[model samples]
Target: MELNNKKVKELLPQKEPFRFVDYVDDVDKNNKTIQCNYTFKSDNPIFLGHFPQEPIVPGVLLIEAMAQSAILLMLCIGNEISLDGEKYLLSKVEEVRFNKPLFPNQKANIISKIERSIPHFYFFSSKVYNGFEDKILEGKFIVFKK
Candidate 1:
């Protein structure tokens, strides 16, 4: 199923200026995968200090966007997690590689899939790609339920 901005806002724990996901392009409950899109605006506050002369979306923010996308997918499809009460923490970021630089006003797609799940932690493999299909970043992250 596809989730629009409003549904995404209501489902995701993050608020504006912090929520990175713009739309859920696709979701596969059976495979535990999700494809999401995000656009970095020129006016984003981070660009002010990151490099005003040549503002680019930071690598850290890209990771955050990927993580947010993964969590949103799980929350939307996982029957075990309650939409209102469950809290999740990003416990680990692993093997992150930033291959391309993303600039302001650019759009990227986050493709994420659950790789493993332990007692309290969910592991996800994710990739961020620009419109031209250049890989922006790829990594695995573990999110712990609290």
Candidate 2:
């Protein structure tokens, strides 16, 4: 189904600007995959501290955004599961690769797909890329709702 920008922001935990994801482009409830995007604005608070003369999106926040995307998708597809019963969290990240640097006001695209799922564990991989589809971040991640 198609998800708008506003709905995506609400699904994520962070507030604006600090909320790295901008929109949920699509999610296949059956396939267990989702696509999202984030536009780095100049006014983002992280920019002020991440760099001074030249600003860059901190790698750690980038990972957080990616993880958020994965959780959002799981929530969408795993409709039978209740989020409040336990907690949907990103439990692991492996083989993470950052291919490019993200500066202010750049568009970051994220694509996440669920690789496996059990009653308690959700495994997924997400890739963050620039507008041109050049990879900025890629990793295999999982979350345990417990």
Candidate 3:
């Protein structure tokens, strides 16, 4: 099903300042993949401490964005499983590489695909691309539903 930003917000647990996903571009259940977008606001509080003169989106937040995207994908496809009270947690992050720094006001596309899955764990390969379509970050991560 196609989900708008409002619907995406409803599905996501993260709130303002922390929720990185701004919109859902696509969700392909057959391929187990999801595409989402987020724009780092220049007024974000983190900029003050991260760097005053040159603010950049932290790599950890980029990873968090990918994890959020992955969770959205799971919620979209796993209709049989009830995720009402349970939360999805990052179990592990592997081979993460930041190719470019994301500055405030820059919009990024986050894409995540399920690489594999076990009982309660889902492994994903994720990437974040800048507006010009240059890959800014790439990584593999595991999410555990608990």
Higher lDDT: candidate 1 or 3?
3
- Candidate 1, 76: how far from true, in Å? 2.1
Ten-residue stretch with the least lDDT total in model 2: 78-87
How many clashes (backbone atoms < 3 Å, residues ≥3 apart in a chain or on different chains) does model 1 have?
0
TM-score on alpha carbons, each prediction: 0.95, 0.87, 0.95
Candidate 3: which pairs clash? none
Off by over 4 Å in 2: 80-86
lDDT of 1 by residue, 1-146 (tens): 89899888888888888899999999999899999999999888899998989898989888889889888888868774346787878899999998989988879899999998989889999999998889999999999877
Candidate 2, residue 92: lDDT: 84
**Model 2: per-residue Cα lDDT over 93-142, one tens digit each:** 88899888988888888899989878888888888988777789889988
Q: How much lDDT does candidate 3 score?
A: 0.91
Better of 2 and 3 by TM-score: 3
Clashing pairs in 2: none
Each candidate: what lDDT? 0.89, 0.80, 0.91
RMSD of 3: 1.4
Q: Give per-model CA RMSD.
A: 1.4, 2.1, 1.4
What local lDDT does model 2 show for residue 4? 78
